[model samples]
Target: MSATASFLARRAAQKERVRILYRRALKDTLNWAVHRHLFYEDADRLRERFEANKHVEDLETVERMIADGEATYNKWRHPDPYIVPWAPGGTKFTRNPTPPSGIFIEKERKI
Candidate 1:
């Protein structure tokens, strides 16, 4: 690949990684904050932390920062992050799963 193409591909991958990191951090904030007020404050701080490096144009530096952030987040991540009761891996997950194909419940409506 040309140097420009390689840089563009790396930039796109970096953007995806950054997006994932931010979302993970936000959800982890919810796990740590019991009250909405505190959560908002924590979220803002997290945003500031990200914004602090928003202007760094160097790809290597951004990658290094991303790696550092991921490491720190993993170090402090909640042991049991909150999951919606009905979501996958949740307590209610698959509790009332759909019936098998051979066991149809409702009859089909004729057109």
Candidate 2:
């Protein structure tokens, strides 16, 4: 690939990585907010923070910002992340047995 093409590819990948990081951070924030209203405010703040960097044109600065953001996320991550009751990582799912209570499977009949 030409130099310009390679740089563009790397930049695209960096953007994608930043996008994924932002999503994970947003979800993690839910673990810290007890009420839905509080969560909306937290989510808005998070969106603003990410949007503030949307106009950045310097690749190096973007990389630095992403690294800093990731570091901050790691530093403040919830010790006990809140998982939805039906989610794989949550207690309701992890501690429950397979098939659950009301699920039914009808056997296929051979024609």
Candidate 3:
């Protein structure tokens, strides 16, 4: 029973990694694609690569493939990935954070 649970937990983690990798790869692809139509084409090709491996029933193979994909992504990742202005590490992040309410500091008057 413990073995089955361990296998399932590991499998779930691997699946999550694959999802993250795919999203990162897709976004990185967008960084390189200068036009929307080209991005769409790249996205479709990316989906096909994932779908091609969807039928593998072997857990070990799946694990290996996920690892390989992650390595590839990290190796060729964008040097400066695009970030939304309001997101963390973005230009507008915390740009104008709201001040705490009801706290006022009066400037000291100079003589």
Candidate 4:
């Protein structure tokens, strides 16, 4: 292969390796009982809340549920933002409105 082609191939291989590592780490973390417990608890709570209000056939209620789910997902995904040093009323750095595409590493994956 030409030099450029060889370099590109190597880069592709490295990217694949990184992706594999990311998937493995995520699987391992989620396999833990604590992770499973928290996930199921949050999921069950959300489901119960939705079911309790299922009889309310109003647009506003549906919208509220959607918003609540999104907020919960965000909080669970980024618990650190709500934790120390960035507690309530503290100077908080908002996330990028549109995160750049490609290989975005989550905080948990780094641990």
Query: How far is each candidate from the true structure, as Cα RMSD in Å?
Result: 4.2, 6.0, 4.9, 20.3
Full-model lDDT for every candidate: 0.95, 0.90, 0.90, 0.51
- The residue-by-residue lDDT of candidate 3 on 9-88, one tens digit each, is 98888889889889989999999888999999989999999999988868899989998998888898889888999999
**Residue 7, candidate 3: how far off, in angstroms?**
2.8
User: Per-residue lDDT of 11-94 in model 2, one digit per residue for the tens?
Assistant: 998999899999999999898999989999999999999998899978889999999999999999999997788789766875
Clashing pairs in 1: none
Report model 3's TM-score to 2 decimal places.
Answer: 0.78
Task: State candidate 2's TM-score.
Answer: 0.78
lDDT top scorer:
1
Q: Choose the strongest candidate by TM-score.
A: 1
Candidate 1 accuracy as lDDT: 0.95
lDDT of candidate 4 over 4-46, digit per residue (tens): 7976775565446434443433443343326667756655654
lDDT of 4 at 80: 30
Predicted candidate 2: what Cα RMSD to the true structure? 6.0
TM-scores for every candidate against the unseen true structure = 0.87, 0.78, 0.78, 0.31
Segments in model 4 whose C-alpha atoms lie over 4 Å from true places: 36-111
Supply every candidate's count of residue pairs whose N, Cα or C atoms clash at under 3 angstroms: 0, 0, 0, 0
